[model samples]
Target: MLIGDVARRSGVSARMLRHYDALGLVRPTGRSHAGYREYSSKDIQRIFHIESLRSLGLSLREVRRALEDPSFTPAELVADLIRQTRERIAAETELLTRLRRIDAVEPSGWEDVFQIVALLQALGSKSAGKRQSAALSSVDDVPLPVEALVEAALSESDPNVAGALRWALAQSGEESLALLAEGLGSPAAEVRARAVQSIAEMPNDGATTLLREALTTPDLVVRRHAALALGVRGVADAVPTLIDMVVEGTNDVDAADALSALATRPASAKRIATKLADRLAEDGVEPPARRRLTQALADIPGPTASKALTDLSHDEDREVALTATYILGLRAAR
Candidate 1:
């Protein structure tokens, strides 16, 4: 076919097609009698593959390398692409987090803030993680000061303050975990919720029991945190209980946490996904729930989970539409 035909079919401009040819990214299958380039169906397939990789965040150079070598497996190329995309996402998340902290700082103390800003500028040349760690370490270790900060964090109604405290505590390791768990037993519901999250980060028997007990706590926030903690733990034992909570419970927060936790166990996740698909077939489950279940299936990595998610992606529900797309991307990466 002519360049126009390839451009129309591939949604890539004619100029790009010629540029790709120049870069040897995609060459014609043959040449016409008049020496014009002739692209066959196979060429179009290559174009489509390139387009897909580009959409997934691969640069032209990276895509060209993958295409040049026939020995390069699709799985390997997709894995590299996914790794790059994840790194980009992590960097962007960290930048956004820093911006949020900067925005929260008061503007009244201009002189001191400006001096600190200049110092930060010098430190910013280092890695973000390193800079953050250095800044935290520079603070005085007086117990009263730390306690006051913790108290302020606990009393503050803002989620952002809670999140910042969580992040800071997470970086402190065991001490942070101990502090958060202690906070959970405090009078403030917000403090308890934050503590539950910190407990979830601790992958020990003590943390597990704490989470389990929190599930039965009187406070809704505590119960919700327990469910979240269980999910993050990815413990197989929690799966059945979470499933029961989903099926028999009326609390949306609990149900959401159960679903999140259920998605972490590979074995139980597959079982639950299959059960959800069966329920969908029977027309007994709600569309939103079915879609959430489908997404949960996709989130659990492995061939069995991928196959289940792929099947559910074709479900009539629009909510599950992206689940299939994500599952396919993961499968491709695998």
Candidate 2:
């Protein structure tokens, strides 16, 4: 076959075949009497081999080494190719995500696109201050897609940046609730906790509903955060988990404060008091936990709480008795 015929059949252009010949990658095996290049069957086979290697992202130099070097080992080269491919794929995926986020914003012009891109880059910047500034400024001009805010909120490790991201997500109202709800089911414990915390900042009813659903999650951190948010919203359903938080010593102070907030309601105050008293009466209740439970009851009004405190004032544990007595005195002073 001549060069043109080989180019036509093998899909390698004639120009590339000549370039390959110049590089000694593939040379025609013979010449015609007219001095034109001619390819033998084996030469065509070598061209096919070069094309095959190139398909696997091999550079021309690597392809030359692979085809001609007797000492070359394929294992290391193949592993390197795999690593490079992975990196390319990761870069492409990040680009696709950013493009989708930009598209979701419905940018009005090139200027809007540029602004959104700048904000996104800042959100991922290495400096915590930059990330926080980006989060705070997200809603200033171009409205960033709620998905971006939720993703940032979930992955942010810096406390200030995380708080800013959560605040930004809250400003998106109920739009971010769905993504944050999915975050609640993440296999990562930290992600679930972040999800709950972000949801806590959202003031809409949809966020409240999700927070209520999170009350029974198996993640202790998620449940505690959800319960505290619900307590802030005056949701009576948070009372049980808030009590559990007091017993477990996980954010027990905030849990007690939430319980106090809930107890301000006449309808739920007695119920909250009864639940705390019951926890204090449990057989294996530790002294520290029991003390926390007693302190929690101090803020709760209604006769049930008073009667529980009066009974606790004479308890066998000295600390518990003194705490109950001090609370009773405070109540008397009131």
Candidate 3:
């Protein structure tokens, strides 16, 4: 077959066939009597082989080596091609995400687009100062996309930068709540904690609702953050987890403070006192934990708290009884 016929049948363009021939990649094996390049059956098979290899992302040079070099091994080359393809896909995906974020900004002009891109790049910068500055400036003239803020908040390791990111996200209002909630489900404990912390800063009812839901998560850290946030919002449902935080001695001080805040409400004071007293009475409650629980009761008012302290005042442990006596004395002095 002539070059034209091969091009027609194989779907390879005439120009590309000539380029292949010029590169000595798929030269025809014979010449027609009319002094034209002609392809033998073996040459046609070689062209198909070249096309097949090219489809797998092989460069022309690699294709030639694959077809002609006896020492060439395809295993390593194939693995390299797989790696390159994966890299290309990742690059494309990142570019697409960037474009989507830019579009989400609803830029009014090219200058606005440039500014948004600059801020986004800064958010991902290696310098913590740059990231924090970017986060602080994000709520400027053009607000950064909430998604970008959430992503930064979840991954940030620097405490200051993370706080700025969380602040920026909170400014975005309830829209940031969904992404932050999704972060709560992340397998990384740090990410989940960040999500809960960020949610805690959002004062909207949506955030409060999500925090209430987070109270039941399997992660103890997540639950503690949620409970503290909820307790501050006067959500009585958080009382149990806040009490648990005290018992486990995880952020127990903050937990106690939250409980005291919740106890200010008349209806919650007795219930909070009862839970604390029960934990105090549990078998093997330990001396230190008992002391901590006893101290926790000092802030709670109402007869429930007063009577519990009165009962603890006569307890067997000297420190416990003394601590309770000191608290009751302070209450009496009031």
User: Best TM-score goes to which candidate?
Assistant: 3
lDDT of each: 0.62, 0.92, 0.92
lDDT of the structure predicted as candidate 3: 0.92
lDDT tens per residue, model 1, 254-292 = 554555556655666666666545554565666666655
Which model is ahead, 1 or 2, in terms of lDDT? 2
TM-score of each: 0.40, 0.93, 0.97
By summed lDDT, the worst window of 10 consecutive residues in model 1 runs over 140-149
Cα deviation at 288, candidate 2, in Å, is 2.1
Higher-scoring candidate on TM-score, 1 or 3? 3
In candidate 3, what residue range of length 10 has the lowest lDDT sum? Answer: 68-77
Model 1 misplaced stretches (Cα beyond 4 Å): 1-150, 171-188, 201-209, 218-220, 237-269, 272-284, 302-334
lDDT of 1 at 69: 72
lDDT of 2 at 259: 93
Model 3: residues with Cα > 4 Å off, grouped in runs = none
Question: Residue 253 of model 1: what lDDT?
Answer: 46
Model 2 weakest lDDT span, ten residues long: 139-148
Winning candidate number (lDDT): 2
Candidate 2 structure quality by residue, lDDT tens digits, 1-334: 8899999999999999999999999989899999889999999999999999999999999999998788777997899999999999999999999999999999999999999999999988999999999999988879777888899999999999999999898788788888999999999999999999999999999999999999988888898999999998999999889998999998999999999899886778889999999999999999999999999998999889999999999999999999999999999999
